[model samples]
Target: MPQKNPNPKHKSQNRAGLLRHLNTREVLAMLLKHGGLSRADLTRLTGISGPTITRTVQDLLDAKLVEEGEPSKALLGRPGKMIHLASSKAGVMALVIGQDACEISASGLDGKLQGNLDRFPMPRSYSEFLSLVSQKLKLAKPKNGVKLMGLGVSTPGLFNLLEHKISSCPSIPFLENQMLAKDLEANTGFETFLLQEMHALCLAESIFGESRNLSNFAVIDITHDFGLGVVSNGQQLQGHLGLAGNLGKLPIDKNGATLDAVATDDFFCKTIARLADSKIDIQGAINLFRGGAVDAMNEINLMIDHISTGVATVVNLFNPERIFIIGKLLDAHPDLFVNLLEATRRKSIKASFIGCTITRSKANSRLGAVSAVIGKLTTGKKFSLK
Candidate 1:
């Protein structure tokens, strides 16, 4: 269905270009980590040759992916021009797909949002969702000269890296086994990558939240399901098929009840509804607890115990230096975070819990989306001039 290039010299040139692009990505990644660096710094940090660094930096400057900053004062010799990401030269788009809604936002390279977040109800089917996203992206295209780099999606589910599709998503059955990232890229013409929601939150934590400088930390998402994301030695621990954090079905108790069976937003919501003998949302249940309703308080305490079990398991297993829990149920009350912290410390191994700090996460999925785009553009894959 397609034509192939037969020219041997053309193939060699293309290979050379790809190698150069990869070297440029390595330079960009180094810049992203350190914020600003001189040409010598890049060469030293990346182990790239001085000439390659010079050529790569010039190409980046021409592409507007990087800009020259003030000259640095050299202690031993002449100063060098500092290179940094051009925050205003281009922007990236973030799409977070939750059970109830889909959030779309655009941010500059500096990770600052350019405009207000736009949200839409979750479409009923895959085709409908694709169409909606495509249409919305068309309307959200930048009118200014700022080029849009790519789109990053934060989704709640297990993504099959081997198959390049969503392998499992209980909340949205329509997403299972769907090639979501590839389809989005095909439809929207934006470089797209999909990550589990918790992974995104983990990235957000590392970039913008409390885990910024920590080399070992864990991010737990206790929403409709229980999920875990871990960072060790400054790298995400993605096991086979990037499914290392699939903790929903983990057997926590001897009774054979799964983690999600006892500790989940849906479980808490349903338990409170049954206790109150009425259909109520999670926030309403929190309000009931705040009002000193005896039944609500009991249910809340039990929910905390379940959450502590999950958190304690994470501590004992991963031995993370810090743990961040993100959930509406966890943030419902001022005392919940403190109570959970104390309870987790009690349940986990004393040595493992010694220095681990359990805290509530303030970072949302939006930052994760932004980090995803930056990661793809700089490190995930080789880029193209086209």
Candidate 2:
């Protein structure tokens, strides 16, 4: 068990070590974020000496990590050229997990797509999932020469950041809350990173999606499951065991039904199966909802109320700037948007909570698996202990 309240400052050298760990790209990122700055400015901000910053900047220029630029007038001394990360070269791999299959995406370190994403369906066992992950990485290596930095994986399960183990996850039965890092590295020839699907959603939202400007926000993925991921005060607050924002099992109905029970893919399929007297596609249910099909509408309304209760609980607890709803089905049938919003507002504790926008994920539902793969590719390697 991890000691609670352990300090993170030990590995860092007051400041210089922290700056040193930033790497060439991270240094450039600092400059780009603070606007054009001299090496002296960087040294002062990062606590690294001017000389080290000078050498690192020169190295960056040499490696094309940064490009030369005109000097900014803010420099009191000789107008040194400012530098920034050459976004084109940085890359990452994303691993997206699904109930029935897993997807992989190779992205630039800057989070841009870098390769053709491939899908690998899941087998019933953990070993099979491991084999599938290994096979997918081998199959998806870039033909071009982009060095893979690491692998990042997202799963619909809880993660234990303190122990680096997955504590308990009902969606994925393969992992027994154990550390699979070694097994992953051995199989993929790279360090592996595993994060809760909700946490990864937080990353996507913070960097490139709707939660970009919000200090506190919630991302609810209404897909095969009602998975919820959160960010509070601009930082993700993973619980002691990294199960901070998982709300799928929360009982929202007065009868004590869980959100997953009320609104998951399984619910959708079964509801439609009985309503239509035949199997219905997940996407097809929306059209039926729009057509005023009594049973479909009733189910949709029930789901909205159930979701509203969960969202209300999240809002009352954290009061985020916005709420993002993402899934293959929701994004496609944005026509249901108003009904959801209305239900959420009506059921929420605050009838007048300021500045919360509920929206869908920008990444397409079809791309969920690919995004997961790229997510793993980018983050997996770093979480490994050297």
Candidate 3:
């Protein structure tokens, strides 16, 4: 259906260009991670030759992907020029579509937030959702000639990359079978990517949260629903079916109740209402728990027990360097969080729990989306301003 390239010279030239592009990407990634570095530093860190580093840095400088910073003050020898990512030169847009709301933001490759984050009510239908996102993306575009590199979307579902569609979303059923990334790209004329919300959050944590330097970690996101994301040996584990962290579907009890049914916000609210003998929501339950209500304390303790069971399972299975819990329930109750850690430590193997740290996620869903886009950009994915 397509013509083949017959010119060997053309193919060789293309390969050379691709290799150069990849080298430039490596230089940019180092600048983004460590702030600024001189040519010598890049050569030492990357183990590339000084001449190769010079060529790559010069190419990046000419392309405006990097800019000269303050020169290094070396007392022994001449000061070398410092290079850093051009944080204001270009940016990527991100959309975090949650069950009830959507947040759109644009961020630079250096993980700096560029513009005001826009929030809107999530639409009920798939078409409406796409339209709303398109409109918001336009509003979130950067000003002052800053290039828009691409778009990143974070949603609650299993994204089937081969099929180019979302396979399953319990909270937003209309998303099933929708080619959301493709449609967004077609509508906005920008390269687009999609990530499961938990994966996005885990990426954000790995990049900018408490687990920044940890090589192995797990993130348990417990909100209205539950999900898991794992980073083993410095790589995010997306299973064979892109369903590695679907912990909600895993049975947690002998009766076959899944983690989602037993440990989510809805489950906690219902448990609290039943225990208090009154109709109460999540915020109300938090209020009661904070006030030290006996019934609320008992219900929260039960919740901690269940959550600790899940944590123990993760620790035993993955043996991560740390575990991060993200949710309003854990955020609102510090004491409950401590109790959860203690209970999990009690249940897990002593060796597994020895140096494994468990902490709360610092970034919200919106910032997580931004981090996802930055991640792709640093990995050498193609993008454009137009």
**Strongest candidate by lDDT:** 1
lDDT of 1 by residue, 1-386 (tens): 78886899998999999999889889887887778899999999999999999999999988878889898888988899999887777888889899999999888776778888899999999899999988897677655788788887888887777777788888899999888877888888888767788888888787657776799999988877788999999888877876678677877668898878778877877877787787898888767656755256666777788789889988999899999887887756788878888888899999999978887788788888777778677776421111
- What digit string (tens of lDDT, one per residue) describes model 3 on residues 232-342? 998888776566686777776789988788787778878767777878878886676667663566656777788888888899999998888877777557677888889
> Worst lDDT window (10 residues) for model 2?
377-386
Report each candidate's C-alpha RMSD, comma-separated, in the order given.
5.6, 7.1, 4.2
Residue 225, model 3: lDDT of 61
Better of 2 and 3 by lDDT: 3
Off by over 4 Å in 1: 1-61, 67-84, 251-257, 271-280, 293-295, 380-386
Q: How accurate is candidate 1 locally (lDDT)?
A: 0.82
What is the lDDT ranking, best to worst? 1, 3, 2
Cα lDDT of all candidates, in order? 0.82, 0.64, 0.78
> Which scores higher on TM-score, 1 or 3?
3
Ten-residue region with minimum lDDT total, candidate 3: 377-386
With a 3 Å backbone cut-off (N, CA, C), the pairs that clash in candidate 1 are: none
